[model samples]
Target: MTNMALSGHTFPSATLTCPNCQTTITYYDVSGSSYYGCPNCHAFFKYENEGPPEILTTFQPSTATPVLPIGSEGYLNGQFVRVVGLLHKKEAGSFYRWLEYMLLRQDGRYSQLAEYNGHWMVIEPTDHTYSHYHVGGKTYTINTDEGQYWLYNQYKPELLNAVGEFDWNCLEDEKLTISEYIRPPSMLISEQGATDSKWYKARYISRSELATAFGIAKDVLPAPSGVGAIEPADPDDRSGTLLAFTGMLLVAVFVLQVILSIVKPSTQLLKESYQTESDSSGTIKPIITSSFDVDGPTVLAFNLSASLDNQWIELPVTLINEQSGRVYEFSKTLEYYYGVEGGESWSEGSRDDDAVLSRIPSGRYHVNIYPARDLGKPVSFSIGITQNTMLGSNIALLLLLFSIYPISLFVNKQWHESQRWSNSDYSKVYTEEDKS
Candidate 1:
């Protein structure tokens, strides 16, 4: 689309010549502002300024503090009223709040609604009793446009005589007319009683009332494919948000470094109590007289059924702390884990891999042995509790020396994942999403 101007397009307005009138009428950018026109034409009409019309009310507005009960008085809008909810933008682009209300009759049952981006509409009914109007005896026309989805109207809260922050306590008490929903703090009426222009204006109030709104729970069914949370219908605050994130990340980096620097207690300071053994009859027991200690690079739990004779099985060995006089019972056997080379199993090192949490407080706690698996079967495996394996004291000491590292790594990893999620689909996200 290209067209050359007929004049030296100067004067504030980028003027265009009207074809019908041939008069040089100043054109306006899509945004209505400055205009162009040959001021001499007797038919010197003004610019086609089609913007949000100024709202005017001449009725004496009301000011009822406590919101009128829905069943109290004027609540229904001729059976076709709309309940407008607000998400008043406290600050341009900060965060939005939610408002909800109930519409009677034609608007459906306790239908739920929300701020269609900070703006909503309410129908000013003509009668309070039979709040219904029909056209041609069959079709009905609604008096309010606030119930539908994706609609907005902006108005000056002051024009409606609202102070601080006000809400339309009741529909019967207020009647407002919004010409166009656009930029401008236009009229936000809080109609209490009879009203008119100049002499009266609508009042506003913030009532604490819950609308019997109905909505379904979020769907959690497995997705057929990648899906996303609908983008928030409103703007988001990224500046301050991003800064908070950056601060969290720096803290994490520092901590992760410290953790990697802490010296994990030498794997050399540990002793085992006993070893595990199984007979040819597939029976097992701890090979301990009372309690023994051995280096912990431990492994190998096996059983054979060959030269078997008399049948007898001892209950599995359970762990207990004689110091506290508490016998820590095990079901069959307790499993342990550690990061190891590919060939290395969960019990990786040769019975010496120990980093257990046994000591935390100032007490002489001892270890016991019992089965933690195969409920009825006798435990026939030699398990080792090195002097330092999972020592609570050692772990606490380790955590204190450098809580920043692993914690930072964990938190940073988590934060990034959250950011990724906020910007991505829930189903497709994972721990790696926050790698940045």
Candidate 2:
């Protein structure tokens, strides 16, 4: 069956495949470029007998195929590519899990993967190459040529090979250097060499082998000069420092919020309160007063009537904080107070008084009261807000939250994305920046 998992605007089967094994071949698309491999024989190929391929479509298994075995070279992801790579950590955990992936691109750019938690989990590569291989009964894949090289070279057996120096049960057995055990010859260069004018060099060896060939150990490999200050390579120290700094920052923010909340000024109980005046004669009108310096409206009330025979005839309600503006549903409230008498103080309970102005901001206000029996004489009363209870506490809490998480994520994401590391000496196939 055709692989439904395969996807791209340019299909792989539509590109090139090995005639012998029929496995799809991938390549770097360009004039006069070529690659080598045979899936059936499980053999590596070379471009020795054939000159650089001149076109993507014209290079067939017969014309481009040599005894050295490069069958077909197809393009991937709009760039000419045939390989993939990744960096893995050997972690010690419950049942063993490889938790991270660091991928390299054609331009030596690096990208990391979605984190993982598992044992013997073989994840296939994404984009370009179908390089999933079996390692310890699980499938592993390299998505790019550089990734392929990095794994097959730096840590060869871990990525795609099930037998890494030893079988699963015999993991502790000694293994010999790959070059000492494997032969070095290409089919393209026969006993009777091909008459083709061009021949490709065979440098297909593990990176460690290549290092051995070049007499350069990894330790001896010079760090590229002038990139930046080179710190002594102690991995644990860097991580510890970062975590400590983050914890300290969080503690500091929490302490500051507590201090700010404590320092917020307390409001004094309403002073210059509860003064009243009653009018002369059989009816009564009481005017009450209070002092405040709030920025919004305040209200004060007085009892004038309870029964229909002595109900409030009318009342003057004015919002007098000139600096503040408002529109009120005073009619709804007036209907409740009208024609009602002195049974409960019109300002009888504090809950009733607070309810009237709970939603209002700090300010000054006045209301006039007249007994229903005496509709002509409504007496005015002054009201003022003592304090704004919501503003200060809410503001401090908001600042504390912003200091911790969402704000931190925004800053950290930008910092990570902006970070660009150079790997020019490390790889050639992955030439693009690791935008992942």
Candidate 3:
């Protein structure tokens, strides 16, 4: 009787007698497969020129089994591919290990499914040309005809074990160098051997996707660990959209400010200069301004300015309503200081300042100013009052509020990028120099 395994898709099989253990081996010589490691006897065989296969090597039988068994068929990438071979390899001088499944399509093209740390990737050969770039100081970039890529990893793989069939002799002890360059969710891999070089492109695949493709339970699959090398940091990043929104809001706020300024221009109510006066008994009398009428429901700006070399003046003032005898008391301080420090001009304190009283009702009012100076010298200052003034501070506050979210998004994006690159040798954050 012929032994066959079928799961929707089927493959033709042949039987070969293992010369070492004299046990019959069932192999799927699918798509020009020429090498096989006997499952029962653990002996490697190679077939050439339609002749009887010759034994290459033999090993103690292993108790381990592959996750995706040999001869299993899976629908992947819009095509049905058979898992014809499996190879277990580990990075030389490191504990990193991975499993590679050689997949054969009906048209005889080969692809690979690789798994590391529970992360999976579908790898396929590419024919496009590429250029290597190393701009020094931890910058390793690869420019392909397709796009740009950043160096992710470089390693040498030592084969640990193998089973099933392959296009080349899997038992050969050949040295190969592999390099991976990534562009997030996709990677470009270069394999260099003693004789030739080949390039392949690999895309990240999720465990759920693989389960659906192979008709397996997702819970039975390996759970993922840390972030994969080429996995997307933020698949739904919206930093650009947020920046555009912030820019639009800024323009809108500026236009609104201009419109408001033109509609209710500030009207100067009173402008006067005052000097402190003293009575015969040396009692200083407060200076008073002429009464002014204010329109209801508007902002009143009290502006004060003084000229001083390095002195300060304080004015305790009150807005008194002549009709109601009600007083609104406030105070202002003006200080100016400047000097040359270390051959550079430095200045602190302003010669001019203003305070605003908002929502003042319509009424006749007068200002009372009680002046005090740092020195006993007589202090002279100018005071101006304006109505319905539109403050630039309001617009500045709105701009800051609108910019906060976009700035936060930018910072978060940069942080995620740094985390993604943390595993790479060319990490922008923790570089090799930093590691050393």
Off by over 4 Å in 2: 1-40, 43-384, 387-393, 396-436
Q: Considering summed lDDT, which 10 consecutive residues are worst modelled in model 1?
A: 199-208
Q: Over the stretch 1-436, how does candidate 3's per-residue lDDT look in tens digits?
A: 2254434454667666666776766666544767877777777877655677788887665534467887778898888888877887778898788889988765568889998878899999999646778755666778766677888788888776677778787644237788898887899998888887888999988888899888888987788787787766554556667777888888887787688678877799999998776779876778889999988668888989887668888888899889989888889888888999899998899888889887888899999998877756666789999998876677678878887877787677667677767776674322567535
The residue pairs in collision within model 3 are none
lDDT for model 2: 0.29
| lDDT score for residue 407 of model 3 | 73
On residues 7-44, what C-alpha lDDT tens digit does candidate 1 reach at each position?
A: 21111223434322454433212233222222222121
TM per candidate: 0.25, 0.24, 0.73
TM-score comparison, 1 vs 3, better candidate: 3
Give the least accurate 10-residue stretch of model 2, judged by summed lDDT.
Answer: 178-187
TM-score of 3: 0.73
| Best-matching candidate per TM-score | 3
**Model 3, poorest ten-residue lDDT window?**
1-10
lDDT of 3 at 145: 60
The TM-score between candidate 2 and the true structure equals 0.24
